[model samples]
Target chain A: MVRFIDGDTRVLVQGITGTQGSFHTRLMLDYGSRVVAGVTPGRGGMVVEGVPVFDTVAGAQDRHEIDASILFIPARFVLDPALEAIDAGLDPVVVITEGVPVRDTMEIVANARLRGTTIIGPNCPGIIKPGEVKMGIMPEQVFRRGNVGIVSRSGTLFYEIASHISRRGLGQSICVGLGGDPVVGLDFIDVLRWFEADDETEAVALIGEIGGDAEERAAGFIAGGGFTKPVAAYIAGRTAVPGKSMGHAGAIVQGDAGTAIGKIEALRDAGVAVGDLPGDVAEALGGLLKG
Target chain B: MKLLEHQAKKIFLDYGIRIPRGELVDSAIKAREVANGLGAVAIKAQLPVGGRGKAGGIQFADSSDDAEMVARGLLGTEIRGVEVKRLLVEEKLDFSDELYLGVVVDRRSRSYMVLASREGGVDIEEVASTTPERIVRHAVDPVFGLRDYHCRRVAGLLGYSGKEMFSLASVIERLYRVAWEMDAELTEINPLALTPEGFVALDARLNIDDNALFRHPDIVEALRLGGSSDLSPREREARDLGLTYVELDGDIGIVGNGAGLTMATLDTVALHGGRPANFLDLGGGASAEMIEAGVSFVMGDSRVKAVFVNILGGITRCDDIARGLVMARSRMGTEKPLVVRLVGTNEEEGRRLLESQGIPTLETMEEAADRVVSFMGGV
Candidate 1:
C-alpha cells in the first residue's frame, strides 16, 4: 500500500546515456523498480546497463508501457524533456535535476497542471518504496520495509532521519522528497492526502526546514482534520538568520515568516510531535507510533 | 539578484512605464550638473537593499548647490553596510496622492500575484501588518497573463474610477509585463504617485531571478552584476567555486552534502555550544574534486578554529568524499583540525581512505559536531 509508487509501477529513465542517469537507472533496476524504457534525444539505439534507450518519450511509450518518468538531465536542458514526458502522459514525473531556473519550472508546473500531471521536484531526490521499488537516488540500505510514510523537503536530512528510524526498528511504507526550492509542484498536503488513504501507512514523519509556509499549511490541514494519521516532524534551521538562504534556495527566513520556530509551533498545535534535532525526529515518530 | 533603484527604473522605462525625469550620477559634480537641468530634484542613493529612505539615503534638493551637498554626503557612505557609489537625481514631482503596486511570485498559488494598495508612500510590509485590508491582490496566471479585468479590479479597489481607473490599469499592465519579461521575483513601486499628468513611479524595485538570468542576456550584459558586493571575499570565492556558502560569526566552519542537512548541522553545532563559522553545502551529487575544493576553502578561513564535514552519502558517494578528504589533507595539510562523518553509499571505502590519511571520522552528525566543539577545547 505504498502511497505514490510500488514494484509494479513501470519507470521511464530520461537522460539514460548520461553518467548519473545511467548509474542511478541501474541502481533503481537493481532495487526492483521495473525500469522498462529509457529516453535521450538522438540516442535511440543506445543500450544503457541493459535498458533500451529511445529517441523520445513517445518512441519509448510506443514500445513499452511507462507509468512514471525519472529525469536525470542537467538543469539547462531539463525543461524540454520534462514537458515532453508530461505531454506523453507520464504521471508523477520526477525531475532529479538541481538548479533548474524558477521560470522554466513555472512553465513546467503550469503545463503539468493543465495536463493533470504530478511533477515531484526540480531539485529533489525522487520517491522510494522500501523493499519494493526505489524510484529515487536515496541509498537503499537506510530504509526498511514497514508502515511509516515519510515525506521531506530536504534529501540528506530525510536520509539522516530515515536511518535513525531504521535503527529504532521502525520501517517505512514510502518516502517522498518534495524538493527544496521556492516553488515546487507537489506540496505537503498533496502527499498527506495519499498517506491518509494508504492503509499500510500507520504513521508519517515530515521533514521540513525554514522557508516557505508548506509546513504551516500542512499543519493547518492536519488541524482542520484533513489527515488523521499519527504524524511527527523535524523543522531545521532553528537559529538561521533572517534573509539568508541556508543551502537550499527555499530555506530562507523572510521578515517574520518561514522560521523554524513558527513551523514547530504550528505542527505542535496541530497535535503533531515536532523534534529539535535529526535524531529527535526518529524518537518523536517512535513515540507517536507507540501511542 | 536584486537590481538597484537606477537599474529598476531603467527596466521600467524600457517597458514604457512612466518614471521621473532622472539621471544616475557618480560624483557630486555630476549630480549638480543633472540637478541644474531639472530644478527641485530628489537625490536617492542607488542600493540593492531597502530601508534607505529612512536611513537618510534619500534627500530632497531645492537648488543645485543642495543637490551637490546631498550627493557629496551620500556618495562613498555606507547605508546598511553597503557603500553607496552612485546617486539618482530626479525631478521631484508634486503629486496629489500616492498608491502602491507590486508583483511577486506567490508560493501558495504557484503564480505571480499583483498587489495594489491605496495607501502608499510608506512601507508596504508595515501597512500589510497594520491595516491588512488596505492591500488588494490579484493572482495572474502565467498562461492568460495579467488581463485588463484584473488590473481594473485592483484599480477599483484602490478607489480609482472611470478614466483614472483605465489610466492606472495601463501602468499595472506595463509593470506586470516588465516582471514577466525580466523573469523578476519581485517588481515594486512603493509610491505610484498620481500626478496632474498621470501616475509616475517615484521609486522602483525589480529583483530578477538569478537562475533565470541566462535567458535574459541583455540584462546580464547591461547589469554586469558581477556577483553581489554584499558577499564577503571568502563567500564570493566560494560562489565562484560553485559551492553554496553563507558566512557566520563563529569559529567552527561547517560543510555538508545538502542544504537542509547543512542547516541542521549548523543548528546541531550551535546546540552543542559551538559557533559555526560558515555554512557550506557541497550540493547533492558532489564530486571528489568539489569536496576537496570546499574542504580547502573552509579550512582557508583564518578565523575558523575547527572544521566539520558531515556527508550522509546517498547520491553523493562516500568514497568520493573520502578521496576528496585524502586529497585535501595531502594538499592543504591539517592546519584546521577537521572532523569527518561519512555514511551510506560505499561508506567503507570512504571511511578507509579518510582514516588511512590520519583524519579521524565520526558516524553521526551529533558525534561530528560534538568532536569539533571539543577540538575548540570545550568552547
Candidate 2:
C-alpha cells in the first residue's frame, strides 16, 4: 500500500556494475525490493549480487517486466541511460546521479513528460517505503512501517526525518525524495496528490528548502482544498540570502518568492501544521492528526 | 564556477566572436606595454562575478602612463571578495550603438533561451524586471540549432539595421554556437558594441556546466590558468570524493545528512544569531568512515569555532554516526566545541555512546543551534 514502490513493483538497475549502484542494489534487495534485472552496456551475462545483467535496458526489459528503473550512471552518461530506460518502456525512472548538465536534464525532463513517464531526479536520493521495499541510496534500518507519507527535496534530510518519525513510533507509508535539481520531474503538489489518494497514508510530512515556488504552489493547493489529509510541513534555508546560488541547482532563492519566510508563511496561512525542527516533525504530524 | 571577464572573453575570442583587442597583464609594466601598443585603452580589473563597473573595477585611460597607474592601483585590491590579480588592457573604441546579448537555460521553461536588448551596460535581471518591453527573448530548438533567421529577428527587435545589423546577427549566431558547443549554462556579452569599424563584444561572461568538464579537457586547463583556485582543501577533498560542499562566511560549521537538512541547519544557525560557515552534505548511506572524514574536514577549518552535526537517522543509524564522531574526535583531537542533534534508529544507544564520551547532544536542531551560538559568545 506504499505510494510509489512496493513488493509487486519490479525494478531494473542501470549501471549495476558501478560501486554505488551495486552497493545500493544489495540494500534494496535486502529490504524486499523486487530488483529483477541489471543493465550495463558491455557487461551482458554478468550477475551483480544475484541480479542478472544485460547489455542494454531494452535487453533487460525483454527478460524482466520492469515497472521502474534506478539509474546509477555518471553525470556524463546520465541522459543516455535515462533515455534508454524510457525507450524500453520503464514507467518511472529514478535518477540518483548528481551534477547532470542543466541542458541535458531539461531535454530529458521534457522528453519524459512527452512520453507520459515519470522521472524522479537527475541529482537526488531515491524513494523508499518502510518495511516494504527500498529504492535509491537511503539506509534501510531506520525506517519503520506506518501511515505518514513523506516528501522532500533533500535525500539525507528526508532519511533523517523518516528516522525521527520511526523513532517516535510514527511510522511512514512512503517517503519520496523529489530531488534537489532546479528542474525536477515531480514537484511538491504532484507528490501531495499521490499521498492524498493513498489509503495507507493518513498524514503527510513535506520537507522543503529555500528555492523555487514549489512550497508556494503546494500551499495554494492545500488552501484550495485540494486534499483532506492532515499535512505537516518543514521549510529549510530560512536565512539564505536571495540571489545567492546554493550547491544544488534547485536550491537558489529566486527573487522574493522562494524565500523560506515566504514559504513558511504561505504554508501556515494554508492551515498546515509546520514543524520548527527535524525532530519536531512527528509532533507536528501528531497535532495534525488530532485536528 | 564563475570566470573572470578576461577569461570569459578569451573563450569568446576562441569561438570567433569579435572582441576588442586585449591582453591580460599581472603587472603595471605589462599593462603599460599593452596600452602603448594601442593608443586609447580601457583598464578593467578582472574579478569573478558581475557589477564590477559599479564596484570601480573598470577605468578608461587616454595614455599608457595612465593605464599603468590604473592597473597598479587595481592589481592588489579586492573587489567583491575576489582579489584583482590581473588587469585586462584593451583598445578603446568609438561605438555607434550598444546592445545586450545573452544565452541562458531557463529552468522554469526547461529550454535554452536567447535574450537581446538595445539597452546595454546594465544588469540583465534589472532590465528584465523593469523595462521588459526593451528586451526580446527566443527559445532555441536543440535539434535544429540556432538559425541565422533567429539571430536576424533578435537583432531586428533590438532596432539593428545596415552593416550593424548583419554583423550583430553574425555575432549572435556565433555566441549561440559557443554556448551550445561549450555546454555553457550562461553566456553573456553585455555592451555588444557596434563601432564604425565593426561589431565587437565589449564585456563577456561564460559559466560552463561543471558536469560537462569531463568532455571538455581544454576548458578544464583554461579554468586552471585563471588563478581562481579559491576552494578550501577540505572542499576540494569533498569534491574529489563526489560530495557537495560550499564554504560560507560564518563560524558554525555544519555537517548534515541531506542538502535540505544542511540548509536548514544554516538557517537555524542564522535565526539564532550564529552564522553557518559551510554546507557539507555527506549524502545518504553515510558510512562510519565517511562520517569520520566529514567530521575531520569541518574541524580542519580554523574559521569554524564550533561544529554542528545534524542527522535524521533513516537508514543511516544514529549509533553508526555516534561511533564515527568518537573515532574522528580521538584521531583529530578536536578541541573545538561540537553540538549534535541525532534522532532515528538506535537514538538511545547513540545518545548513550556520546554521553559516555562526555560529548554534548541536543534533542533538536533549534537547541543545538542555540547551544552552539551561546558557546560562541552569542554570535
- Please report the candidate that would top lDDT against the real structure: 1
Interface RMSD of 2: 2.8
* Residue-by-residue lDDT tens digits, candidate 2, B220-323: 88778765654656667777766678878888888987678788788778878888888887766688888998888888888899899988776577899999
lDDT of each: 0.89, 0.83
Provide per-model DockQ scores: 0.77, 0.49
Model 1, runs deviating above 4 Å: A1-3, B225-228
lDDT of 1 by residue, B158-267 (tens): 88999899999999999999888888888999899999999999999988887788887877776665233456778788888988999989999898989989999999
Which pairs in model 1 have colliding backbones?
Answer: none
- Clashes, model 2: 3
- What CAPRI class is candidate 2? medium
Score chain A of each prediction against the true chain A by TM-score and list the results: 0.97, 0.96
